[model samples]
Structure formats: structure tokens, C-alpha cells
Target: MALVNDRFSKWATGFSGCDGGDIGSPHSKSIWYCGIEWGGGHPDDEHELINKVLSNDVEFPSEGYTSDDSPPGWLYNLAYRFNWQAMKLLTAVSGDSITSYKVFAEKVKPFTKGEKGYFKMNLYPLAFVNTSHDLWKNGFAKATGLDTKKDYHDWIKANRFPIMKTWMDTYSPKLIICVGKSYLPEFSLAFFGEELTFESEIIDDRELSWAVNKNGTIMVVLPFLGNRNGLNKNVSIQKFGDRIRELLTTL
Candidate 1:
């Protein structure tokens, strides 16, 4: 693991702080694919992710992608995992073929670290197997010096949302694809500082919604890519991506 400075470590793990950075290309008006939070990790294990954040091992918010870590095997046989689905959507948006595993492996996954034209972010920093599970909270709280998950979430809401809004204001990213419909309220509060009535449509009986900010950044909301009722089927992803591509041409 590459060594991280104290400031980076603090920014990586802290709840209420700003470091003027994110996990993507430092200078691209790229697509921002935001999720509710990272997914993975358990209660009994050592806090490997936190250690990585402090030591700069895996993907932590900074500038640009990690230098040393190899890309993860998210595209195994084109299974509809979250990251793979996101990649497929992005590829479809770019007017590329999504059916080719070789294309994704050699051409796309390598740049998903944000070297290409997209950013990966989470509204919350902690990693959980899923949102409903809470058993990992104790370990997270202990690692981050917080009392509980509620406190961590509250701090993120009060402090980090504003910072994220500032990034939106400054960068004016053309697209922010939020891939979790359940977090629409949080996405609104984070990006627009209030609840917004998003314009939505149904594809494959799944709801896909969108809202545009004053800065001309479009926030596209979709269901969880990995869960039940997700927008993971090839037809749905292709349709959604095509719609988004069409939408972008107008802006």
C-alpha cells in the first residue's frame, strides 16, 4: 500500500471535513455515478477498508484513480453486478457495444478508477453489505471514533452534503447518475439542499427518474443495480442509457 499523509488519512476517515477532492480524473467534466454508500465488509474482520483508506490501498476519495491497485473482477461473464452494470450503462451512453466482455475487460474496467470520463462516489463513506444491515455499525463507529452509525450519518448530512454541493457548483458536471432510488431524498438534500419533485419514467416496469440543477447538471435516479427490481437487465440498461444519451445532446 502506498503511504498516505496524515491529512489524507483524516480526510479519508473523518465525517466532517473537506479536502477539495474525489475519486476520479482531477480535470474532467465527466459523469458522476453516485451510490448510497460502498458495499462490502463484515463485523468480526479487521477493518481492512479503514486501514486502506488511511494507507491509500483501495479506492478512497482523493483525486484521480489509484496508481497501483489492479481493477477488480466486476465484469465476470457480464453478470449484472453494480459496477458492471454501471460500466454497461456508461458504455451504452457512449454509443458503444455493451455485449462484448473483452471490450469491457480491456477497454473499460481499467479506466473505471476514473481515468476515463466518470467519477465513482457514495453519499456515505462507510461500506455495508446492504443498507438494511446494521451489524457492522459497531465496528465502523469504533474505527472512526464515532459513537454510533446515527451520529456518523448525522454528521455527514450536516457537513459533507454542503461540501458535495460545492463540488457540483464548481465543476458543473454534465451528469450525476445516482444509482439508488431509495436515496432520492438524500440525493436531493445533498445536491439541491431540499426535496425535489423529480421527473420520472418507467422502463421495463422499473422507475427511472431525473432532476436538473441550476448549474445544468442532470441527476438521473435509478433503482439499485444489484438488488431486486434493479435496472440490471440488458434491455433496461440499454434503454436507460440511450435515453440519457439523448437527453445529454439537448443540454
Candidate 2:
């Protein structure tokens, strides 16, 4: 079985709305969530932007007309092309509420201004970590309760941890890779605490990969694919592909 979440349907519907010229459609009701813009009805241009930003050389329609106006099908095609099975799984789980997915899709929609085309760029691939309110309060800190803070960590602890664990247990991927440098410190502190040990070579400022376990499952952190600055100097389009390939080898 594949892992999935509610964001998939939300993305599909949101993109469908954009294609149909409904910019302000409500995709998800959650506070930390908002639908993607897709440059407001530039469905055709959005397709091209996806190819360029992802650095893939493929021709996709820049018009509202797809092989079919089936937004879900289009989303699936994009996911497969990008090797984002995680996205597919999330959509599958969405069942009827595809909030996250729709928001992401709409955000990446393309637009052209005068002679220049604009493409939305994402700075990181989604990272899944194991956590919960109990884990944070008990394992991490009592002060880190859900009510006081509601960032990504809190969101994971409150909403995503249980589902994330279930998915990890079921899918059992050999390697879990995180996509950012900033996430490394928090991830390390979150799971390892003061007992964390790093491989000497990876401790340098360059790209680092290490094993972190929670309830016996292991995770690895790599440079963010979307972070063009900071410690991810070498993390270009080519590097992103290489890193993913390396991760697959480990898997």
C-alpha cells in the first residue's frame, strides 16, 4: 500500500477551479493552508512552467485544454513524470478532501507577462517526520505543547505524526531523506537529542546524510532541492536528480 494524505484532492479541485477561472475558491479550511495561484487561469502556461522549473524538457499544453480536463488525471501524470509517488499516495488517501495537493498545484500555475513568462518555484520537497504532542511534550519538552506553538513541528505533532507513522510502517522504505539544511538541526534535536553522533566526513559544511531512527524506522537528511542558497551550494537541478538517485540506491 502507498502512503497518502488529504492534500491530494484539495490540490486537484483547486487546480480545476483555477483552470475554470475560479481564483478565490476555497481549497482547504485549515489556517496554515492556502490554495495555489497558478497565475489565475493560465493553465497552459502553468504546465510549461512546471517543466522549466523542474528542469525537464518536455512539451505540455499551455492552454486550458488537456487531453482531458480531468484535473486529477493531469496531476497524476505530473506526479509520475516527477517520480513523486508520495504525491500520488497522498491523493489516494485524500478520499474526498484534497486540500494540500490543490494548494500546491495552484501555487505553481504559470503566467506570462509581456514577453517574459513567470514560473513559481518551490524551495523544498515535502518532508515527513515522526512526531506527536506527547512526543514533543514528553520526549522533547513539556513547554513545547501544542497550544503555545503551531509551526510545522506542532502541526506534525498534532495532526500528521500518527498518519506518518502508519505510512512509514506500511511502506517501510529503506531510506527517508529530508530536503533542507535548516531542517537538519531541528530534525536532529527532535529525534537524537544530545546523544546524536555525526559521521566525521558529513560534519563538514557540504552535503550531509545521516541515519535517524524513531521507533526503529530510519531517516536521512539531504540538502533541500529547492534551496538555491545557504549550505546547499551544490544543490542545483542536476544535484537534485543525483541526490534522489543516490537515495534510491540506498533504498
Candidate 3:
């Protein structure tokens, strides 16, 4: 089957928090990584992340992760995974270059905890959304605890799209970048209220396509953002930054 047909096991999303001097630019200091639901959707009790609203002393999964009951294939690194490449893209556009993810994480610490920004890109709440495909996989390690949260799941079914729209509208970042493009159609449905008809344009290494909604939020779909402990080699952060900026200029 095609990559699009495969179910993604990774799912994460966030909004940055830093006053963007250049607010109008697509390369604005803010960027978003639409999470991954790794592990072929094993132990996938994914929720809308009400945990964020409940108590957020630390980020998600980092707080919820417990390996004792987790499935055999469960990769521990999935917890608290940040998109360093996404951060690099932010640094590239902002001119406030960061050398590593460690540096970027440190800088965003205050803001992630809800430090007010005068013109901040606000990365707090680290909003996460599980693709509908995150579930529906045939596997031995099916999800648990889903029975108790039918109401929450109901809310997710009804409000997930609107809530996502709210997040997008509130941040209003020039560019809305997603980690993987396999599920691009689902993303289009969420943002634009219909499936997108798209044609890819090859930009040196990767083929990219753009979908601009009525408000002009350019959704740039690409592969997994960067290395997860030296895996997911298909994603080249350096190449992405180079080609993305160039592509943005053409339109």
C-alpha cells in the first residue's frame, strides 16, 4: 500500500511563544509540527489531550508515559519529542539562529509555561491532534482506556475541527507546516472544510504542494520533520529550509 494508506503512529502539535518582530512573514518565528502517533498505533489511547487543560506542569506523554503497561514495540523516545528541524526553520526565518534543539528548548521554556509575550508566537498548551487514522489499525496491541472516554471522544468528533481552526486562526502563522504529507487529505478537510485537489511540484529533493485557505494560511506538507534518535532519515531539515523559503517566494 501507499504511504498515504499507512496509519501513522505519531501525532503532535504546538504553537510557539515568542514576540515575532516580523509577524507577516511566512518564516515568522513561529512554526507547528502536526504530531506523530508512532508504533503502528499501538497502545493508542490518544485523546484530544485534555491533560493539557487538566494540569500542565510539564508537556504531554512526558507526563502520561508509563512503559510498564506499554506494548512491546512501543518506542520510549516518542515522549516529549520536539521538532528541532521545525525550530531550525523558525530560527532561519527569524534570523535568531539556534544551533541545536537543546538551545531552542531552553529558550522556549519560559513561554511554554505560559509566560506572556507582547507579540509572542505562544507555544503553550502544545496542542496535539490524533489523526482519525491514528486508530483503525489491525493489531495485537489494541488501545485501552477508550471505553471510559466516550464522551470526550464524542467531543473530539464534533469539535476537533473547529478547535483546530480556532488554534490556526488564533496563531495565524503565515505557514502551517505538517510533519508527514501522507495524511494530507485529512488535514485539508480539517482546515478548508473539504478535500483539496492538489498537484505536487518537485523541489530538488522533495515534492511539495501548497494549499492556501481563504485566510491565506499556507499549509506546507512535508515528510517527518527530523531525526528521532537517528531514525526517519528521509527528512532533511537543511534541505527543507532551503527549498521551502525558495518555494514560498514563487507564490
The number of the candidate with the highest TM-score is 1
Candidate with the greatest lDDT versus the true structure: 1
Candidates in order, TM-scores: namely 0.77, 0.33, 0.50
Error of 3 at 116 (Å): 8.1
Worst 10 residues of 2 by lDDT: 28-37
Report how far off residue 174 is in candidate 2 (Å): 3.1
Clashes of each: 0, 20, 20
- lDDT of each residue in 1-251, candidate 3, tens digit only: 11211111112132221212222223343444443333222232333232222222222213111235242112222223443445555444334444543454445421132321112232112222343533433221122112323332333334455445665665565565555567576566555666777657654455566677777666766655544432133234545555566555655
**What lDDT does each candidate get?**
0.64, 0.31, 0.41
lDDT of 1 by residue, 1-251 (tens): 22323433355444322111233333557677788886663343336535554344333344433434343332331443765677678777877766753476456543334444555678886666777645555555555555556766776677678777766776667888887898898888887777888998988898988888776778889888756668768888888888888888885
RMSD of each: 5.9, 17.4, 10.6
Candidate that beats the other on TM-score, 2 or 3, i.e. the better one: 3
What ranking emerges by lDDT with the best candidate at the front?
Answer: 1, 3, 2
For residue 49, give model 3's deviation from the true position in Å.
11
